[model samples]
Each structure stands twice: as C-alpha cells, then as structure tokens.
Target: MIVAEVVRSGFVESVHHGIVALTVGKSFGDVDSPFFPRSSNKPLQTVGLLNAGLVPREEADLALMSGSHDGEPFHIERVRAMLAAAGLGPEALRCPADLPLGEAARNAWLRGGGEAEPILMNCSGKHAGMLATCVVNGWPLESYLEVGHPLQKALADAVSRLAGEPIAAFGVDGCGAPIFAISPMGLARAFQRLVEAEPGTPERRVADAMRAHPALVAGTGTEDTVLMTAIPGLLVKKGADGVAAAALPGLGAVALKISDGATRARVPVLLEALRRLGAETPEIPEVVLGGGRPVGEVRAVW
Candidate 1:
C-alpha cells in the first residue's frame, strides 16, 4: 500500500509503502501477512510473566516490564529494582549491551562519559521481568532466552492466546528473546483484547499500565509517549522494523508494518489509522526539513 509520501517544498521527494490494518469496519492492504511484532509483544509477554507467578512489588513495575524504556534514570532505577527483587543483576540480562534508545537520554549518557551496558539496553526492563519470572519458577536465568525454556514457552502461549492465533513461526529478536510471527489482524485482535478486557484481568492490567505510564513504554519526546499521552484511553507500542500496534478502549485496534522499516513513516500511518477509528489525536506532523527549516511534511494517504 502507498502508506505515506515525503513532500519536500511542495514536491514529492520520496514515499513509504506499507500495510495498515484497522478494525473500524474498514480495511486497507494485506492485514493477513505474518510478521514479527518485535517489542510490541512485550505487554503480552509481561502478562505471561504474571500468569507464571511473577509478582511485582509495585504496579509501576508492571509498566516497566512492558516497556522498551529509554534508559533514563527512572527507567534504569526500576529495572535494577526489579532485578534486585529477584536477587539478580544486570550481568544476568541476556540482551546485548546498548545505549539508551531515546535521543535525549542517549545524548546525556554520552555527555557523562557513559558506555553501553546491559542494563542500559532498551529491552532491559523486559529482560529483567523475564529474569524475575524465571526466579519465581526456578528456571535458569542463562537459558531464559532459549526458545525451549519454560519462560519462553509460557510467553509463546500467552502471545498466541491473546492474539487469538497460533504462532506461524519463531525468530530471534534484536534483544535475543524469541519473537513470534502473527498476522497483522491477529496482532490487532490481541491489542483490542487488552483494552477491552475486564478490569483486573491480566490483559487489562497490561493495557492500563502502558496507558498510565506511556513515557516508560518508550521515552520522553518519543511518538509512542506523545500519542499515548495525548489520546485518552489509548495504548500504543512501537516494534522494531517499522511495526506498531495500538488499541483504543472503545474504538478498535490497529497494526501496521512499513515495508522498508522506516521509523518516520510509522506514526503518520498510525495517526491515520487512529483517525479512522474515530480517535481525536493531537497534531503530530512529520516535518520535512531542508537547511534546518520546514520544507514539507510526510502525509499519510492510505
């Protein structure tokens, strides 16, 4: 699908092609194509942690468990707390060491002469949650990332059950955890289930945590944070490789995958999907800059 076009100074300079699926009684593109949800699957995985007897000391911890945090101070502090509560440490994390994912946070870390570390990885919260779950179940921390491990099996079951579809396949994610491939519509179905599920249910708790702590899900000044903050009762998460999934409590769910994996194209397309679902969102334009000034913008035409 012709999802978005980059217009520079009233001229089309480039375009982004992708698939967008929304449950607003209208559809566009091939919503049935199977793809990895990436970090977008974290919430469902966190639900799996809860089901496996992983009791967090704080409700805010649940937010971190579902987050792809920016490695900001608060984010790192929670991650350490989660691990400490489990008697583990950053050395136990299996995700590759990396700097913060947020622009501002990363800049600050570098300015402080910081180097990449395991706990600083964007996925550390998820990893820490996984480790804590492992401790609760007596599972091996070193093998938690293995697909055959009990933790991974539980996560697979949760993702499948919530998405209402069996996994088409499995692949290693950037964070070293097993990733599931599901249809875009299936992903949308899962997110819808989260928001619409009854209060106190695992799914609803995950949704509530994300909506309540949108900044933890991504970071300050990021699109996911901005969108979730501005749109009431909306839950959104970004996945790597241009994947994103979101649900509005009373509206519907939407999922998309940009064919070229371009980050800039995802939000405009997502905003369009939200608008289709009758969501009132803030004006978030993808300004195209030429010589440090606004030249044009990326517009969604899907």
Candidate 2:
C-alpha cells in the first residue's frame, strides 16, 4: 500500500509504502509474511525471564527488562540495581556500549566527558534481566546471547507460544541477541495475548508495568511514550528496521513493517490501522517539513 506521500511545493516528491496487519474481531492484510520483530520481542522475552524464576524486588524492574529504554538517569539506575542484585556489573552485559538513546541524556553525557558504556545502551536492562535469570537458574552468563543457550531456548519457547506460531528464522540483532522472525499476524497475536493475560501472571505483570511506567519503556517525546500517554491502556513497542506494534485490551492489535525501512512511515500506517479498528486516536500530523517549515504532508492513501 502507498501508506504515505511526500509533496514539496504542490509537487509529489516521494511515497512511503508498507503493509499493515490488524486484528480486532477479524484479521486484515498479508499478515503472514515473516519479518524480524526486533525489540518488539522484548516483552515476550521478559516473560521467559519470569518463567525461568527471575524475581526483582521492584515490579517496575520487569518493565525495564522489556524496554528499549532511552538510557536516562532513571533507566541507568534501575539497570544498575538489577545488575547489583545478580552480583554482576556493566562488564557482564553483552550489548555493545553506546550513548543514551535520548538526545538530552546523550548531550549531558558528552558535556560531562563521558564515554560509551554497555550499561548505557538501550538494551542494557534486557541483558541485565538475562543475567539475573541465569543467576536464578544456575545457568552460564558469559555466552547467554548464543542461540543454543538455555536462556535463548526458553525465550524462543515463550515467543512461539505467545505468537501462536513457530519461529520461521533467526538472526543476530544489533544488541547481539537472537532475533526471531515471525509473521506480522504472529506479532499482533503475541501482543494481543500479552494485554489479555490473566492478572498477576507474568504476561500481565509486564504489560501493567509498561503501561504504568511508559517513560521507562522508551523516553520523553518518543513514539511509544507519546502514544501510550495519549491512549490509556494502550501498549506500544517500536523495533528497529521500521517495525512497530501496538495492542489495546478488548479493542485490537496492529503491527506493521515499512519495506524500505523508513521509520517515519510506521506511525501513519499504525494510526490508520487503529482508526480502521474503531479505536479513538489523537490527531497525528502527517506533514513533512523542510528548512524548518512545512513543505508537504505525508497522507495515508492506501
């Protein structure tokens, strides 16, 4: 579908195309195409950690474990706490060192003469949870990112079960963890199940924590944070490589992938899908800007 179009001075300059999969009381689109879910798979992976006997003192920690956090001070402190509980440190994290994902935090780090650190990586909380899970299960921590590791096997099982489909393929993600490929339908189904899980269950716990602490899940002004704030009870996650997914309890779920890997295109498609599902959404500007001014709009024309 031509999901969005770019115009410059009354001239159509570009178009963004993508596929959207939505499930309310019914399913829509070519949702069975296999694609990598990336960090969208974190919530399910945290379920695996919970199933493997990981129990953090603070429930909010569970949300962080499932987050692609912005690496703000709050996020960093929580990750440090998780590592401390496991008697581990930043050195144990498998994700590569990087500055905070939030611009403000990154600037502050630079201003303070900081260097990239593994704990500051967006996926650090996830790795910390993995290490804690290993500690709880008496498993090896050094090679936890390996596909054949018991931790990975457990996460795969959780993902497959929640997705209601077996993984079609696997690849190494940017953070050095195994990424599973599943259909968009499978991704939506997983998120749907996540929000609908029984109260106090691991799935619901993760969802509740995320919904309650949306900032920890992403950061200020981020898509996930903004969307969650605007729509109550809405669960949203954005993954790398132009992937995004959302689920609202009792309403529906939506998942999309921009074939050309344009991150900006994902939101319009998602909002369109939500509108189709009869859910209320705030107005989202579709205009594209140039030279600090509106040059054109990105409109959905499926």
Candidate 3:
C-alpha cells in the first residue's frame, strides 16, 4: 500500500508525495526487512543498566537513562550530574556533539557564534547515561559502543528476548552506538514486555520510571513526554527516521514506521492508535512539516 498526497498549502504548498505501507490483521510487512529502530530501542536497552547493577533504584535516573533529551539546560545538567555521580566526565562520551533541538538552544548556539557545545548535543544524555552504566559495571570506558563489549552483548540479548526475534541486521546509530533491526511487530512486542515485565525486574522499573517522570523521559516539548503524560498507563518513545512505539501495561502495543521518513506523521498515527483503543484526547494532533507548515494532515487513512 502507498500513502501519499498532493499538498497545496504551507511548506508543502507544492506537490507533496510520500508512501506508507499498510499491513492489517495477521499480515506482517517485510518481517525480516533490515530497518533501523534507532532510539526506539532505548527503553529496552536500559535493562542493561539494571541488569549490570548500575542503576541505584532511582526512577528519575532510569527515566533519564532511556531518554533522548532535547538538550535543555536542565537536561544537560542532569546528564552531567549522572556522569559526576559515576565519577566520569564529558570526555568519556563516544557520541559526536551537535546543536540541540528546538529554537531556544539553536538561537543560543547562534548567539555563541555557531560554536558546538557538548552539553548542547541531544545525544549527550544517552551517552552520559551509558558512561555511568559502564562506571558502575566496571567495564572499560573505551569503545563502549562496540558490539564486542560485554554491555553491548547484554543489550543485544535483551533486545532479542524482548523482541522475541533474532535481530535481522545491525548498524551504527547517530550517537555512535550499535543499532538493531526488528519487524514492526517485533518492536511492538519488545515494548509490550518492557511495560509488562514482572515487578522488580529491570524492564518494569524502566517502564515505571518513564511513566512517572514523563517530563524527564524526554524534555519540555517532546512527543514522548507529551503523549505519555497525557495518556496514563502508556509509555511512548520516538526514534529517529520516523519510527515510534507505544505500549500499555496490560493492553496491546503499537508501532509505526513512516515510509517517507517524515517524523511529523508519527504522533498523529499514535493518536489514531490511541483513539482506536478507546482513549480520547482533548485536541487532535495536527501534522505539520517544517515546523508549523501544513504539508499534510493525518486522518484515518484506513
């Protein structure tokens, strides 16, 4: 199936086109396709921190561990604090630094004459959290992102188990960490286990933390933070390249992949999924391209 449109307004005022594959019922689209889950796997991989005895039973830390923050000052400070607690520093990170998300940080960076600060990098938090895990586990700090590392192996295994499928492919993520691939259904299943893990398990702790501190889970104005906060019992995460997944503790899970790689379609698809499950929101989410430019709208394409 192909999803597309000819936009006549806003940023997409010209001819706007895209494609989305549709698989309903028992059908699975390209079950073994090599597609990257990107940051969507953070919550599942966070189990490594718990399993390796790095986490000290702090919900906020767990949430931060699974987060892809917006690089706000508070977010940067918390990441630094995590590293400090673990006796590590910014020099320990393997992820490359870049400007933060949103206009505030961008404007700040511009004001600083287009200089890149490690704290302004969005993945700094994830990298810092990984470094802390290494500190607590006594693993070598060098090449922590390597697949050969014990921590990486443990994380891969956890992903395999939770996904209930062997990883079909692998690649490096933007943050210099290994990325795993699984079908959309497999991704959904992984999230299901993460949210429904037995009490006292690392997965459960991760889910609980994310649910409790939704704000900390992402940042001030992120989709994961907003959706999870607005909808109780739901844990949502948005990954790179228009991938997103959400799970309800006892209910089912939903995973979406935008074929054209438009991130704007993600939240709207999530809202549709939620509404279909008998959940309602005060306002329908609007899909905007180029930030506030209405390229297309997300309606029931089914």
Top candidate by TM-score: 1
TM-score, structure 2 vs. true? 0.96
Please give, for residues 159-267, the per-residue lDDT of candidate 2 as tens digits: 9998999999989998999999999988988888889999999999999998998998998888888888998899989999778889999887888887788887777
Task: Give the whole-model CA lDDT for all candidates, comma-separated.
Answer: 0.89, 0.87, 0.72
> Quick one: ranking by lDDT, best first?
1, 2, 3
What is the TM-score of each predicted model, taking all chains together? Answer: 0.98, 0.96, 0.87
Query: Highest lDDT: which candidate?
Result: 1
lDDT of 1 by residue, 168-211 (tens): 99999998899999988888999999999999988888899889
Candidate 1 TM-score to native: 0.98
Clash pairs, candidate 3, are none
Please list the residue runs of candidate 3 whose C-alpha ends up more than 4 Å from where it truly belongs after superposition: 2-28, 31-34, 112-114, 287-296
How far is 46's C-alpha from truth in model 1 (Å)? 1.0
- lDDT, candidate 3, 70-102, per-residue tens: 777777778788888888787787787677775
Error of 1 at 281 (Å): 1.5
